[model samples]
Target: MTALSLEERFRTGDPRALARAITLAESGLDAARPLLRAARELAAARGAAGTVVLGVTGSPGSGKSTLTDALISHLRSEGKRVAVLAVDPSSPYSGGAILGDRIRMLRHHGDSGVFVRSLASRGALGGLSARTMQVLALLEGAGFDWVILETVGVGQSEVDVAAACDHTLLVVTPAGGDGVQAFKAGIMEIADVIAVNKADLPGADRTVRELLAAQGLGAHDASTWFAPVRRTVAAKGEGIGPLVEAVLAHRAYLGAGGLHARRAARAEFEVRTLVQERVLRRARELSGDLYARVARGELDADAAADALLAGA
Candidate 1:
């Protein structure tokens, strides 16, 4: 129960210890600082630097959860330890994760090599929980061979997963005009691999062609990594092997230098986000009358924000 013992258990990959550490990280308490620091150090010492952190994202009804479940099975079959962080929309009243993903992945519950945790987005703009990065570091430190991040259904601007993971897998469906939507400027650009799930449905081939055409329209050259569009019927576990192969191919393309660059970008994003969160919290605490002034039209919004920051 002591901090040192907890860290020791965590180093040994104790499941309970990992769970406790993640809860502390999610709490955002000052007490979590040393634990998180130790995790980072342990990860580096263990040579877990090559651990793949895969991000799965898409709009609602895209079968992301089902695809993730298949991935977990495939990875586990290969004798690899895998951890999944499923980010779900927060409940308005309780501000807790809906737990839908956990329920769907119940078959993996007793597997020692598989760890799945659901996180509440808590109003984060990018469909990811603010504590996701820290928790991901803990998972890496816990020695999982792979870490999968499944984001809440995302839109064009909710592509933060690109900065948070080694590779971003954008999932789309064959029906519902998702093919056109997937080619939009923002989300499409971030995808390292795109999965057209529900391939058994109508328009599957058309969707594939549209996605391939969209790739052609992008400003990609021979040196650029073009996202591969693969079709899958995740519910039946069909086409998952090729999807996994595509992901690994993308990883191979990234190479060592490119992977390091992506991790560096992820580190920068975490630092900036933490700084912005702290500053906003401080500003909120000090804006007793500034909000009233703005509401009363006594001070303009921009000026009030400046004053709040100054005080913070």
Candidate 2:
């Protein structure tokens, strides 16, 4: 038996190849550099702009996975190939993800048109993995109609999804404390689309009302988008269409130039993160046992950082 090449499987839209690409992407291996370049090349050749990337984020147990499953059903019914990149928590020591997100999406199993994959956060913050952007390039190039990024546990101060996505859906529920905290966590500015999931519960309407008010106050710029808060009973598949419609409408709202600007901005963010990672790696290389010294309070962090930068 012969092994398949990345190009062969990629051209055929093989999910196995896509999974392999994502693994290599996350590994940060030296050879992964060319894989990144190859992904970019293929994405450009395929005119990857046809794919839309939507990010979903909210507090844990906010029904994010359920909403994602519902949205996948909605998108696939319309004859679209949908892929989900669910970023979940990773074991601190082993770096292996429990992958509960994909577990929640088990209903989509054996469906070729729907690709559900979970990537471990592996200590990466901002609710997304560092390699996610690269994987999106591969997914878009492979011809997925929609790539939904379900971010890590979103709570107070996890606005990282704001940078990684073209459009973001901040999922909030009709629950008690979360509804109030949502407003404080910088959600008003981050959410392009607001999904109030579990709308079947009591107080759903009130949550919507308050979210609308928050949008008003948080609109800081008159030109900024006022996110629409849609009610969704995701477990029952209710309001998924409207939610999907809201996402597409947001895309339409971002005309070609708006879309292009978003892509460019996201690309710039990825590049900046990569450069920072490299610089940090070089700093660690030069620092030797400085981490121990800092930990023991023998050397102050600012001084250690200055020494590291001086060497760089």
Best by TM-score: 1
Model 1 lDDT, full chain set: 0.80
In terms of lDDT, which candidate is strongest?
1
- Candidate 2, residues 29-145, lDDT tens digits: the string is 665566566666665554435778888888878988888899998898999999888776424455555455558687888889988777765433333445766776667666788
- Candidate 1 lDDT tens digits, 146-165: 89988666542247788888
Off by over 4 Å in 2: 1-5, 12-16, 41-49, 89-98, 123-127, 155-157, 219-222, 283-300, 310-312
Per model, state how many residue pairs clash: 0, 0
Candidate 1 global TM-score: 0.90
TM-scores vs. true structure, each candidate:
0.90, 0.85
* TM-score of candidate 2 on Cα atoms, chains taken together: 0.85
Minimum summed lDDT over a 10-residue window in model 2 is located at 121-130
